[model samples]
Target: MSLVLHLDTPAWRAHLAATCADVPGLVPVAKGNGYGFGLDRLAAEADLLELDTLAVGTTPEVAEVRNGGWSGDIVVLTPWSRHDPLAVDYLADEQVITTVSRLDDLKLVAERAPRARVIVELLTSMRRHGMGPGDLPGVRSLLSSPQDSGLRFEGWTIHLPMKAANALAEARELSSAAASTIEAPVWLSHLTLDDYRTLTRELNVATRLRMGTALWLGAPNTRRTTARVLDMHPVKRGERVGYWQHRVSQDGWVVVVSGGTAHGVALTAPSPGANLRQRAVTLATGAMDAAGRALSPYTIDGRKRGFIEPPHMQSSLVFLPGAATVAIGDDVPVELRLTTARVDEIREVDAEA
Candidate 1:
């Protein structure tokens, strides 16, 4: 019994190929649960795509890609700091490119790993990690005399906000600002293909688009997630069940499913509520959660079921009241957040299958 992610191999590969053709200098991001396909699988797919570079979220993830047989250059998207214990080990690797967002960290890299390949990150609207515009001159001066410090300046990176009303405009402003100070390739994220093309046309220096969700999960029809039905028990009205011993309101079946909190079955990230509709939905969901009538991700008999209580570590008890029938070992379709999901196995099927 497990939570399985099934991939339509040919269709997914075709999508990946098409994306690579459309986006120039595409660096596929394979990090943080690997978009539910696992890190090793994405790295191997990157090798099969024959891409020159792969972007990961952290420095420690560099080894996962290398172990997955990705021999090309690996760029860690997270800014490297001297406080990171594994920084030195990853810095010394020639194939590894570290992102430095702070001036002090850039100097640290020069002092520790002088010959390290480095990318200076510029602060954009995201403001997550990057050096501010005010610090660009210092970076430019430091890179101007690279011979004094053996650090190899690869390029500048800017991570734009996904929800910005006009991402391309923000990217253009930031890209232009960096190019004016120091001439180097610009690596970016969260831009449409047209926007990227527009930016490329507008800028003189080279540009690369780093994509994670758009690259891996672009084809929604090519992937499916499901959980196996482990067991089922009939319950009468007012009968208490589950670890919390919550009383049932009516006669139903207590169906045990194979995914729970361990697999991110019911775990949800906080919604940003950018607009009125989103805020309304969030409020509705919160109201339901407070009432203990939250919906589970599992769908059986073409309807979503509800949890008897909060999910357990490896299994969940779903309440299927009236009419709906499910047997043991049946595959129940699941709607999961791919980035947060951790499935037990991934099965690939050909398109014809």
Candidate 2:
């Protein structure tokens, strides 16, 4: 019994090609569980795309990319510090580009690994790890004077917030500011095609787009998570079931399915916004929980099923009201946020078949 991610490889590849076609100079970002497909798999996919560079979120992920057989330049998006021993050791490689967001970090890189390649990250509206516009002059001065330490200035990178209505305006302003301080290409994230087109038209420097979610999961509902039913038992109306012994309001079948916390089943991501609508959604979800009607991802016979209790580490107990049509050994579809899911296996099926 297992939770499996079934991929339609042919269709996925088509989508990948189409996604890359629209965005030129693409730097595919493969990080954090590889967007539920694992890091190594994405790295190989990046190679298939024939991209020149790949961006990762951390230093630890560097080995994963290398193990995947990706020979292209690998850029670490996260800001680096001399305090980090692994980054200090690995940043010396010519093929590696580490982002520096602070003056101290810039100085450290110059002193420790003078020949190391670096991309200076500018602060954006996102307020993540990056240097402010004022920090660029000093960085330019350091890059201008070639030290034997060989600190190679690759380009500039900026992470943008998704909520801005006019992202191109912000990107244009930011790109102009970055270029004025130090002439280099601008690496960006979270920009629409329109935004990219507009920015590229106005900005003289080259623009490289870093994308992850839209690149891999371009087709909606293309992937599915299937869990095998392990056991089934009849239950009486108002009968107590599950580990916490939650009471069932109606007659149902208690199902033991092959998925739980370890598989990322039923785990909720943090809410995105604190706006009224988001607050209302949170309140409604809480209300459902209070009423013993919490929604479950497991779907059987084309309908969603409920949980008998909170999921376990490796399995889940789902409550199917009324007569049980499902049986042990049967597979049920589970709707999952792929980024958060962990399946035991991933089977890539031919789209044509």
Candidate 3:
């Protein structure tokens, strides 16, 4: 009952639906530990979203999703490897689409998986995933050869990180170029409402945006998590507790509540009060070194407590003043970094009680 993440699935689903409403043909991405939901569950949620295609990070994951009966097109975002064609074919017969960033890897994949669908990824803002513009011409030449038959060029994909306007702008620019050269849909990422709306009026080609966070976790900031407080303790200024040399101070309550490093309850974002918002997380750890004090999300006797030390792997210590009545089995609400933590459970808000 303690240290569990009670996900508001309905609220999360509604949020995704609302976000994807303006963008037509949204392809929800489920990759990398399923962003903490453990890929399989995210696959189920994506299917529930009625998506025709899902973007995963690897060829191995394709079987995990396909074996579960997810027949949708498995689009592997990672570039193709000549070392593995049989693996790709098994994940997708005609529907599995693999991404290629290097020109040399293209022909190799074609030879490996004769019937594999392939997507040529162009380098966008996130240079980590695609091929540079100079390499595309040669790759195009390789694919157009009458002799090559195994791998078919399905579409183009652009993975633009977090830049809402830039992502759409780059998509439009790439679409104009791809239209003149090849007849294929262009896949995209990190787009906003206005970006898609802008693309609709300017670009003519089919564009599909892949979304993971927006689809599963909803707004990064709006979703709040909660847990139940399991226990509490009374201690003095020099009282000792916890593993290692951790001790209690302030001559107050030694609060042991539900949620910890394991529950996804600790905050990764810098304190909201920080002057610079994004770097606050790193800055906080630095502050802890200077002040010799550690803090975490702590709710006490119904009043939220402040962290007294760095969080333990399974539990954390919160400092509470006297007069607080928080007891064992009492529930506490917390804000967590959804990207981290185990995401032990996903539940509704009504069940938050």
Candidate 4:
């Protein structure tokens, strides 16, 4: 019994091919849990797509991509620091491009390996990483002469914030600012399909879209997540169970499913949106939390059930109403945020003509 992710290979291949056709210069991002498909799988997929570049989050991820036989240029999305000497050494590979957000990092890279491959990240609204616009002048100067810095300048990268109001305008503004500093293409993320198309057409500079979610999880029907029903117990009202000894208010079935926090099941991440509607949803969720009746991602008999308690490390306890029917060996479908899910097994079915 395990948490499993089944991929409709034909559907995914078709979808990925269509996405590649739609977005030119698309660099598939392979990082962090490999967007639930695992990094090696995605890297292999990217290679099959014959893409020229693949972006990853860290040096370890870079190694994973390469080990998966992706010989194309590997761009490290995260910024570099002197603390990571091994990562710096990895960047020495001509095919690996390290992102440098701070000028100090650029200086450090220059000192360590002047001929190191580099991509300068311009600070965006996210403010999580990247160099400010003012700092680009220093970046341009340091890398302006090969004799001075010896760094192989790649391009500028800007990661936009999610659900931006005027995303196109913001992109235009950032592109203009960055274009003025470096005469290189822009590597971007978090743009909608329409935004991606528009930016490619309207912007004078070349743009490369670094995408993961939309490319991989864009087709939900093609991918299925399921958990096996390991055991089941019938309970009457006020029966105590689970580690917290959470009591049932009514007669129901406690279905012990093969998924839990360790599998990234039932684990919640902060909502990326903060709009009024989202805030109201947050309040409603809070009320559910207060009532200890949180809706679970697991579905039984084509209907989602509620968690009896927070999921255990390797399994979960789900409460199904008295009338619900399920067998111990049955596989229950689950809806998961792929970015956060950790599937124990992945089963890929060949596409059908």
Top candidate by lDDT: 1
Looking at model 1, residue 262 earns an lDDT score of 85
Over 4 Å off in model 3, which ranges? 19-21, 67-69, 83-92, 145-147, 219-223, 265-277, 301-304, 349-353
lDDT of 3 by residue, 1-353 (tens): 45555556666666777866756878878776676667777778777777788888777888777755577888888787656765545534677777887777766666666666788888776668677777767766776663565567777777776744456667787767765556677777777757766776676677788887767776544355666665677877777766545566557776666566666666465444534664676676678756756555554455556676667666666777655566767766665666665655665464244
User: What C-alpha lDDT does candidate 1 achieve relative to the native structure?
Assistant: 0.91
What ordering of candidates by TM-score runs from best to worst?
1, 2, 4, 3
- The models' CA-based lDDT, in order, is 0.91, 0.86, 0.69, 0.87
lDDT of 3: 0.69
Poorest lDDT segment (10 consecutive residues) of candidate 3: 344-353
Model 4 worst lDDT run, 10 consecutive residues: 266-275
Q: Please write out the lDDT profile of model 2 over residues 277-333, one tens digit for every residue.
A: 998898898888888788788998778887777889999988888888899999998
Candidate 2 Cα lDDT to native:
0.86
Q: Which prediction has the highest TM-score against the true structure? A: 1
lDDT per residue as tens, model 4, 1-353:
68889889899889999999989989999999999988888999999999999999888888788788899999988788878875778667889888998998889889888889888888888888988878978988998787999888888888999767887788878888888877788888998879888888876778899999889988887888889999999999999988899999999899999988888887778875577998888889889989999999999977889999988889999999786499888998988778888988898776563
Candidates in order, TM-scores: namely: 0.98, 0.96, 0.84, 0.94
